[model samples]
Target: MLLISRENRELLRIIEEQKPSSLKELEAATGRKRSNLYRTLSTMAQYGIVDLVRSNKRVKPVVKATSFQVEFGLDEPSQHEKRRS
Candidate 1:
């Protein structure tokens, strides 16, 4: 159950729009630094938020998910609230 930050939500949106994406492609698409993007991807990977789809030498990393769903339970804090605190 991911809290679904703005960045994570945007990443999912980009994935849905692009179908498949690599690290470089996503970095470019989101205008985020490669290192930061990688960190976010790693976090998502740790949570099973995204599935690694493909990779290439010239291109960036790629991933896919059944659906971009943010499962925020009543007990969990809202992303906005988390950010505030």
Candidate 2:
């Protein structure tokens, strides 16, 4: 079944909180260390769930969810997914 992982949830949370903001500020606010936050950001970026805004001395990435209410479950696959299954 398609699903979001725990790290994905945490990443989404961080983005929601830091959104329209920056990761350095997010680290301060969320108490997540830079390393951990960066790793999550990179993974989320790969999934197209987040986007990088700019890269420089500091990276300012933004989050973009597939939907405001994306499904995060472990149920049987949908018809489309079942085909792949």
For candidate 1, write residues 1-30 as lDDT tens digits: 343677677777787678544677777788
Total backbone collisions, model 2: 0
TM-score of every candidate:
0.57, 0.58
Q: Where is the poorest 10-residue window by lDDT in model 1?
A: 54-63
Assess candidate 1 and give its TM-score to the true structure.
0.57
After superposing candidate 2, which stretches have Cα over 4 Å from the reference?
Answer: 1-3, 6-10, 17-20, 66-85
**Local error of candidate 1 at 40, Å?**
0.6
Score each candidate by Cα lDDT. 0.67, 0.69
What would the C-alpha RMSD of candidate 2 be, to one decimal place? 5.9
Off by over 4 Å in 1: 1-3, 53-85
Question: Lowest-scoring 10 consecutive residues by lDDT in candidate 2?
Answer: 1-10
